[model samples]
Target chain A: MTSADETQQRPAGDPAGPALDRFYTVIPAGGVGTRLWPLSRASAPKFLHDLTGSGTTLIRSTYERLAPLTGEKVMVVTGDPHRDAVCAQLPELDEADLVLEPSPKDSAAAIGLAAAILHRRDPEIIMGSFAADQVIAPVEAFQSAAREAVVTAATGRIVTIGISPTHPSTGFGYIRRGQALGVEGAPSAHQVVEFVEKPGEETAREYLDTGDYLWNAGMFVAPVGLLLQHLAAAQPELHAGVVEIAEAWGTERQQEVMERVWPDLPKTAIDYAVAEPAADAGDVAVIPGHFTWDDVGDFAAIARLNPAKEQDAMTVLGEKARVYSDQSSGVVVSDTRRVVALIGVEDIVVVDTEDALLVTTTDHAQSVKQAVEALREKGDSDVL
Target chain B: MTSADETQQRPAGDPAGPALDRFYTVIPAGGVGTRLWPLSRASAPKFLHDLTGSGTTLIRSTYERLAPLTGEKVMVVTGDPHRDAVCAQLPELDEADLVLEPSPKDSAAAIGLAAAILHRRDPEIIMGSFAADQVIAPVEAFQSAAREAVVTAATGRIVTIGISPTHPSTGFGYIRRGQALGVEGAPSAHQVVEFVEKPGEETAREYLDTGDYLWNAGMFVAPVGLLLQHLAAAQPELHAGVVEIAEAWGTERQQEVMERVWPDLPKTAIDYAVAEPAADAGDVAVIPGHFTWDDVGDFAAIARLNPAKEQDAMTVLGEKARVYSDQSSGVVVSDTRRVVALIGVEDIVVVDTEDALLVTTTDHAQSVKQAVEALREKGDSDVL
Candidate 1:
């Protein structure tokens, strides 16, 4: 069955029996957007900006997009700096839905945290992990695909929503789809064969042409039992650490367990620590997401999502404001109480704040965090 | 002989040469620096900035550079908007020396005005015309060159100073030098065969390899009578009108003559109006410039003049700074309040102003005024 193009077309009627009604969303908002510096500082990130002028951020927009599939069953896990902003921006999510990370860690830790929290609420809970920074369009289709993924997860297989590859993008990792999985009427679900690292452009082009490679969008759906079993079998150390942190969930000893366990845990991505292992286990399933998706990694990608009036331009705050951005372009944001002008410049970013100014090229936007490291190296801790 | 760089050296044996010498200096300060825009505005040019860190603006610096030969013999002729700045910067010059124009009629009118003024003072007075933005090293050698030119001008010939080109430069016009025509012991001065405009890269390289072409630095010394003779013979309208204006100097009616005459003056270069014709007249001579000279026309030229510390990069106002400016260059005016960084960018100009900001590629710096035009288009008059 084909889903409508517009997001608002909710399913009017489904003569088939109702699907599993126990899935909940877990938003990993703890990741920092180091590449989009100045705009995306330590206090804010890509998910926080109203990128599309819809008066909503990516996190808030993503939640609204999933409303039909799992109404009011979402949780946001963020750090201290963004905790207040997340709550302030999304007043609908109560304090209980906001999971605080004691310190910054990888997505694996976040997955464990989400699973533990869901286990406490319901041991058999179907959990779907969503990244706050991703953009998924055609909401109705995403909802339908996600609903199918949740149903597949209830069947004891770890399910991931793999985005259909639209281009030969070298920015994202690829998921090789295998033999077709059983979906009553949905063409979006498949059995995942393998997970590949970010490939060369030539290889990515091949995958795009083949139509079997799906972008590993870093979204997944699984039952608490299934995830815990995978973690226990594949990553026993992480499983033990998660268990320790979860046991201290509602006590004064919570910070103690977190502090002791987090720093010592291995730093790895969920793809390397779980998805790759799951693919090897031969039981993992892939749900091909029938939606437009973007992981705003750098200025080039950000410019694409917020396409300029011209071929490669992107405007930020002021609508009347004009930009001559190329595929390699950023902007000049001046707080000088006067109009700022940038001419004949490409690939560079100039972000002016009330007190501080950042002028660097887009290729170096990711290394801005290294400036903080430099400050620390020189013992200029105050700057950091 | 190539002279050693020494600034502000004068006669040890003949100190009191010309107390009120009839030597006149004409400053062509009409250019709108689009490359250095926001800093170098339409109202303010590079000659107004203390760009060299010697406590003098470029105009003031040029004045200081010529102080040895033309002691109190300076006259600054600029457009109406920059008249006050020119006057305010060079306080030693009288109000009469501050020649204001209705619009930028260019070098032809400026030279004509200088000739008229100097002719009024003394028909045989030697006049030296200098651009307000050039940087001349070794003031001592520059004065020596001017002294030689003044001696040559006393014989009623147009003495143009031709600098020995250090590279195959396509930026400046070239003067093809003929056989030498100076005293036995004096520096080499040749007859100028022809003046060529900025050439293509290959032509410039050919000119450089020939070793007979010197960069036409736009500096010239000639007697008022000689310039007046050529102007009357060729551009008779401009000459006749300027002569009427000169004869009625300091009278209430002179202002009328200026208003009536200047508005109708042909828009042309002094090279076209006098030098090219004078070459056919066989009265133009090229004296080799003793001092190292640079026009500081664009950012690339500026970078070549002011080489970077580590390599050949130009860093301006870089303070408490860690910079890696190289073949990929930019002006980094560091605010101690903020850390500025750049990477993988080439031929860029970054200017930080209190009310406006400008960042442009050096190659595109010429179009930076277009950014100002854009600001004007957007009705941002204050910033423009």
Candidate 2:
């Protein structure tokens, strides 16, 4: 593996200047997206879908959004099942930059493996990890915030881009910002007071009223060495396992080591294993991001992102001409070639797939996962 | 043409004695069933569907219910397009008994033509006309009512089987009953005072409270000659056209006369052309039916006929095993072999077919026809 100091240089097309020359984007692309089924199946999850009807898949959009800042320094860590799909969707990504996990070990192992690989290649590389399934609007604001976060991460603190809350959302974890860091290159950087789990509606409303809390978008930026150090201190076994895999990543023994050690790695989110513990130690910082962001959590969230042409018409995510609706409102994910007719329904969510069909309302979007579970329990794996 | 005095006799399966010996059933199997939409298209309408999950199509169920009383005396009157489907569904019907119309000329022409042909075959034959799409439960009560209606028709009056009201439903028209007829064999028979159209909720409630009104289920029984005489007096042109078609029915000129006269015949319902006017002329009698009957007008009616196993489960018209529902109600007509999962929807109507899908609620079931119209307007006849 070559070091950043020896191989890294400002790309000709990079408009962010040399300040971001050493920045690398690591995208953790994995999630079953159970709530979005039958559109998002286990074999083809949400990250592989062009959910916004924008003619680009979510992973492709993520790659495009970060390409300007990181140039060719983008790496994606996905499960083996989705490895080919991710590569096919993102043809611009270098084959060497695609890290395929043998099996899911949650966000902790997925991101930590990418961090280990980046650290081995360039110890000084400032890596920012974004989920492949999120939707971020107003690219300029995200770029500005990411640049500032990268600058702050160079100062040896684990940093996260906190989305400024626009509503009292109980879906995402809340990050409480304490005192201002007043860092020279990053003026918006603040000391993360504490990280809290997803709260109840009342607590979320209180969080909005307090004006001190930001939505923890699960986006983190840090020097590869610093993130690895936190991981080593908090979860030594997981850290050591990833380190071994990273060492063999570019060698002939890569597949052999992965097959032996991958499944044994601890299954945990990075927040519980690193960010929370690091925040408790007063070694965490946050950059307030003004850009809009969403995990595309459910159909209701998808409806909000893609508003219907008319208030009463459904917002179709596939071929709009195939849908015939009257006095209906909400979202329709139509992947099938057949016509979908919605009449006199309100706030409905209809997902028409080839082998399965889902009909529900926006209010019960989260309960779709229960249907998936029921199907699995019934041994109907073909649909799942 | 032979008369009933020479042809009518007790068949091998005749169970109602000699009074019903000359009785025959005429089922008018027309109507596109537009409100059911994709489940009931113009090519394959609702009459051919097993909407109640009873393992029998609506027309087949109609035949099975009346077969005990009429034996092989049952006749189906349908347009040329549905002739094959009606025959395929009802294999027991004699080829001579299936009255195939060249084109749709509405109820007056269809039923009047059937009556005209039956009058020519057996002038004393008492015929009862029932819709091919209605669901009549507790066949015993229907048999008893029809027996009384036949006896009342023998008294030279146009008798109708009126469904006793179970609720203040505004869906069906009300038939106001007059003084009870002092007849021995037909004790429940009463003189029909008048026929009223579908009323408002308050008016329906008032009618229900009066105890003198029964739902006009459009079930009429009369001697073939008496019905023709009423049609001849009320709609002379339509009567002449059907009479001309009937005169040529069994001859070599059957096809020629039908093609020439069927399209030009007056398109009017029997209620307007004969029944309502006959009631004003003091010739219509009413036999109150105690059996439960539904026209299966829409998904709401289907839900009532096929109640869900659990309150939260969907009332599926197809294979219930293919449906996975949670906190959902109303009905689902799944013709496709795909799994349908409904979550958090209330009173929803989801009809999944091979070429189209319909998603709505029971309240908006009537509006499904609008979707079909819209699809037609958009030149999406493939789905319509």
Candidate 3:
């Protein structure tokens, strides 16, 4: 039911919804999302799903969210299997900007490849790489943050939009913001002290208590050349490979180069390959993102993104889902037209698809992958 | 995939395998069974489905369990909706012995009508009324106990097979045993002091502590005339209505009489109309049954009856069900070919049907009816 027109509409006179003459938005759309199995699968990843029951799928929403700032300067990097789905969801997308990977790689290769291609196009253009499967609310706030990050990135710093921690969540990595950068057109810009791994419960609580930490949402706004420079230093082989592919991109050799070299690229998340190392070298800047964000990591996160329709009751997704919840508080994501009835269960998560069904609780949402693993062991590849 | 031939095999030379010339078996196959919703619907009650994956449906198993003793004298009384399914499951069942009720009625009406009809056929013959949805193990033991009950019932007493309580369960009613009856060939027969209602936990524990209590599994064997005599005394209106229907049975007036009188018949469980009243009048006898029995009351009881296939794992029913359990223990009753995967949740219960799916836990199995009630409130009658 979602309209693609939402991605084309630009708010007038909005501080960040104006022409960003030399800024491009790169969307890295990859992730098997096994934790959301049955709803999300290897054949069709989470980015292609409207997990929140929102009209648009996650990737479509991402495209629309970033469209106003980048206009036609948007690029989506995805795996070969999702090429048609991504194109179908983003009809306005230019073929020249849609990067289809030969196979899945880590965030570093995906984002690095996009940056290298953008750098080859225009060395001075500032590019922001955002993941395709995350959800953010109050578009204006995120746009304002992106505007600030873009402005801060113009000062030769790799800027990242850090989300203010809503809770002491141990599932996400933490970004420590240091002194204010005092940069032009960016009041919230601060120097990054360090990028920390997911913390233990005690340390996370401490981080929340001190209020000096923000969740590293893996959003990067930097001059394409600066990101490529950092990538070349931290992951030389991956950088060389993506650069080799980028050099032939849009040429007849594009698919040939990607298929030959993509698989051997060093697989690493963008945080480890660039952000963390650059933070250690004092070459990273942080822009606070006041907007709500979630990676749509698992059913638990999906429930958070799509709050319960009734207070403390349930969050249900799917256009044709007929769910009757009685004395139950949980999440139900159904793709089929079947009626799902839940009674007297708290914090439960039920994912119903045409071929498979998953039943667990939010407490075990992270363990959903264990079921997927078991299915793989049993050679139930049809479901996988 | 379950073979119906299992319902025809009779153990040769078993003590209760043959030669009960004047006995008949009455199988009462009724009950909406909302607690097992999606699996057992109002259209197709629990007795019509093979719930235990035991190669025979509940009613078919009940029929076969008593076939050795009663031979061709078994009569099944059910609502109109299940006529075809019942006949399909039991091809050997004579059409003359199949009694179809026009609508849902209480046990007193279903079994009492069967008893009244059998009374009209041969009042001197002993008749046993057994619910079609229960499960019993060690058929020989149950048959022996039933043999004793029939011999004891021959002495003009209403005999109930009282299963020895294996645990302090508050779900089933208790039958308090008094002194031994000392009847020949019925060595375990005893006087029933009373038939108690389902007790509270504390009282049930107390009943278990003392060995005088046995679970009243609603199995009653008696002379056809004796049960009707008690029924006529305790519930005169229901007795008259069924007796009127029986009078016109097998004639052109059969359907006309049942349609006119069945709906308005006094609705009452047979236990209240006969056994409890007979016990009060010191006309009831108890026969100790040393066999495993389960009413398949709810998912919890179902999980117990169909124990987990793997240790501390799960119990899954449905021949085409593709289930992968990982670090989870639960019960899955599927009627479709869906792959049901469970993660870390324990004691979960999932029922996947073609149009409806139910997710709960054994702890809340009884509350499944609440979902059904909610669905009814929403006027979702098609799935109901």
Top-DockQ candidate index: 2
Clashing residue pairs found in predicted model 2: B4-B122
Chain B alone: TM-score in each candidate?
A: 0.85, 0.93, 0.93
- Give the TM-scores of the predictions, in the order they appear: 0.73, 0.89, 0.86
DockQ scores of the candidates: 0.33, 0.71, 0.65
Error of 3 at A291 (Å): 3.7
lDDT digits (tens) for residues B281-367 of candidate 1: 789988787578876656555555555555546466533444333235656543234544455566666666656655666566566
Candidate 2: docking tier: medium
| DockQ of candidate 3 relative to the true structure | 0.65
Give the Cα RMSD of candidate 3. Answer: 4.6
How well does candidate 2 reproduce the true complex, by DockQ? 0.71
- The C-alpha RMSD of each candidate to the native structure, in angstroms, is 6.6, 4.6, 4.6
lDDT of 2 by residue, B272-332 (tens): 9899999999999999999999888888888889988875777888764488888888888
Highest-TM-score candidate: 2
Which of the CAPRI classes, incorrect, acceptable, medium or high, describes model 1? acceptable
Residue-wise lDDT of candidate 1 within A1-384, one digit each (tens)? 112322233344541114345677888885556565555666667788665656678788877776556667788888867877898777878666777877777888788777876787788788888888877788767877787787777777789988888789898899999988766644566898998999999999999998999998888988877787778778889878887887777678877887888778766677766778878998688988878887666555555565545544434443333333323346454333634566666656676544445666767656667754654576644323
